[model samples]
Target: MTLRVRDLDPENPADLDGITAVLRAAVPPMLVTPELLWWQSARAPAAQCHRLLLAEDEEGRVIGRGSTGLAHESPEPGLAFCNVYVHPEHEGRGAGTALVSAAEEYLASIGARTAFSWVLDGERNLGFARRSGWSPSRSARFQRLDLTAPLRPLAPPPPGVELRPATAFADDPRPLFLLDAEATADEPSDVGTELDDYEEWLATSWGHPLLDRDLTTVALVDGVPAAFSIAHTDGADRYSSGMTGTARAHRGRGLAKLAKHDSLSRARAAGLTEAYTSNDTENAPMLAINEWFGYVPAVTEVRHAKPLG
Candidate 1:
């Protein structure tokens, strides 16, 4: 009946599979392939100092997992995050608390002055966060669309605009990066981020394992990327909208919607049966866009923050 939390060795296949199993059991909709896990927890740049931890019982079976890392892209310093998840069958154990404690200690040791975590919107999860001295800050909604159903046809782009797959920019993704950076700065979030380092963005985001370039759609205004819909696929039937945004200059042109529509159509054609995306509760425009695309509310999670001296 004993339980212990330990840092997961990224080089160990057993640990990777164990975490993957935990994720599958807890969050079935979000796909977590080995490649995606490695890209996130292992290949993260040294600046982020990402750490993945697992909680195991006396039998050495993984029943919970935690992820901790700095918000490296935030222009504001001293911000970090730690999210903990336990198997439903093992919720009453101390694994979640131990993992969160370890995460806060590690972050504090690394110079973090404030830590953030996402707790599923529920009485138990909220109660746990409250007991740990964390307060809810912002909430986000996860939405999913049945890609197997017929999607409304996308309207044609303006005469000067053309819709293209993100793969078209493979030889040079910097343009898309610029668009992403601009759009990201405008997106609603408690933890604001700016993509200032091109190399870092290239290493972490552009090179992410789940990113599906061929299915990602972009709107080109006279051959310049004006809006884009970044897609992440699990190599199966699941697809996620990593981001769907338009540059400020192109906001009123419906370029963002065009990009997302095209991306969703391509994803369905690619045999992806499910589409998932998350939006800050206050992001009304994005929320309306998702609703138009037939995405239904799946779950909500509140961002909890705790200040650490």
Candidate 2:
């Protein structure tokens, strides 16, 4: 019963099914499909440096998987991530450790100075990471909203801001991309990310399949994009907010709330009955906005960091 780690080909349907199963088992609250998995791997920026590795048992079943690479946009270089997941039923079979070892070696080969991972908050999960030289650093919560239930009527757009759909930028989306990059930098997190490569951004984010351009809401202020709430759907009732953020300069104006409300209203109208989103526990402002929109915490995941020797 040997375990081996190898690259996962997005073009292969079997790879996607295996990866999706691991994702669902590891993080059941987060929705995933073949389309979403392929889109994510296929569109990763070749320059920013992304890699997805899968662990297979002797029988050729994927028992674990990891995504390892450097976040080039981050101001700090060598910042890499690798989350290894072993199916709950197959824990302690050496698959998880083997997966992490492969991911770490790959990241180190790519000049990664630090490796980050998200571990499901629990005794066994945390203990595994600790034994492997990883330490808890930060935490985040996943929340879900019942879109089918009655929701508070969203207020009209403010005096100078207008609620608009992201589809409006289809003709030219560079502006929205720039806004997304800017807003992401201000987000509270243990791993600070900076979006520097435009082309990679186009491939990884702009080219995502689940991104619902029509349902994403952007708040415009005098022709400028101040805030936005991005939505991703799985062609069914499940919907997720990729991000909802307001520009630093426009933080006090409640544009994030306005944008998110518009997004939720549009999502409900579009037949999405369930909405899920995650937020850093320290991001009080964003959490408040989500709570206002009827989002309730569903799960907690902890960020773990391991310093290389």
Candidate 3:
């Protein structure tokens, strides 16, 4: 039976559910759902130019999924990404290869000169990526913490520091945005991103459907947002940290830890059962913070890259 690859029709309910199932099958811990997929592919900032693709077998069952797009926020030219995930039950059917090919074609059509993707840290996935001309790069560790466990109480903030919910700045999140941009610039990554567009940041990050401003914690210095722990909820019991960082000037003050601790405590109080976060293995500071919070490593993913001709 022949396998075919095509763009996912988000408008079609079956296609949406099929792709969501494929994602869940590939990574059971992922918080992906049809609603989240739609939010990403259809409502994300226009600069992202996101595309979703699906691979179907002769019987029209979706066995693989691919997400592709240009990294619009990056100052570099011709930079793109394509993440492919195939159901474990259908691995030998060439669905992954087909999906990658289609994704690359789409990226090239949009003038992308390079592509990046994440492959699970395993021999099979690594071999497949190497076979596709992708070379290994920096890796990231995903961690999870059980909210049901006894959490360490958050220590009081320093005399001049204040910890509060991000929602307090709903009328003006510019201070938080500035802190995020500064922290993001210093984060360890193969692809350096510059968040120069505040409007774009507002639309994509601030207005995101999953963003839980009420649960997100922020540490302020003299009323200026200096550190934050952004939160995203699955509308269930699962919560994920979108980004946690402290401004350069506030790095040694333990503000990031304070914000994260406050956020996690609030999350547990709000009945959130699970919390997840990921960090570059090279980021010693953040890793140490996660360790202090009792977050255990769940999965490791290796970043891979290939040049486009």
The number of the candidate with the highest TM-score is 1
**lDDT-superior candidate, 1 or 2:** 1
Higher-TM-score candidate among 2 and 3? 3
**Top model number, lDDT:** 3
Q: Which stretches of candidate 1 lie over 4 Å from their true place?
A: none
Which parts of model 3 have CA positions greater than 4 angstroms off? none
Per-residue CA lDDT of candidate 2, range 101-213, in tens? Answer: 98888888878888889998889999999999998988999999999987787668768888889889888888888899899988987778777667667777777788888
Per-residue lDDT of 1-309 in model 1, one digit per residue for the tens? Answer: 798899887777888888888887777666688777766777888988999889999999899999998998898999999999888888988989989999999999999999889888899999999999999988998899999999987778879999999788889999988999999999988889999888888888889889999989989999899999999998889999999999998897788899999999988988889999999999998999999999999888899999987
Supply candidate 3's per-residue lDDT for 42. Answer: 77
| Stretches > 4 Å off in candidate 2 | none
Predicted candidate 3 versus true structure: per-residue lDDT over 78-162, tens digit per residue: 8999999999989978999999999888888889999999898899999999998999999999899999997987769989899
Residue 26 Cα positional deviation in candidate 2, in Å, after optimal superposition: 1.3
- Give the clash total for candidate 2: 1
Find the number of clashing residue pairs for candidate 1. 0
- Report how far residue 236 has shifted in candidate 2, in Å: 1.7
Candidate 2, pairs of clashing residues:
73-194
Name every residue pair that clashes in candidate 1: none
- Cand. 1 Cα-lDDT: 0.89
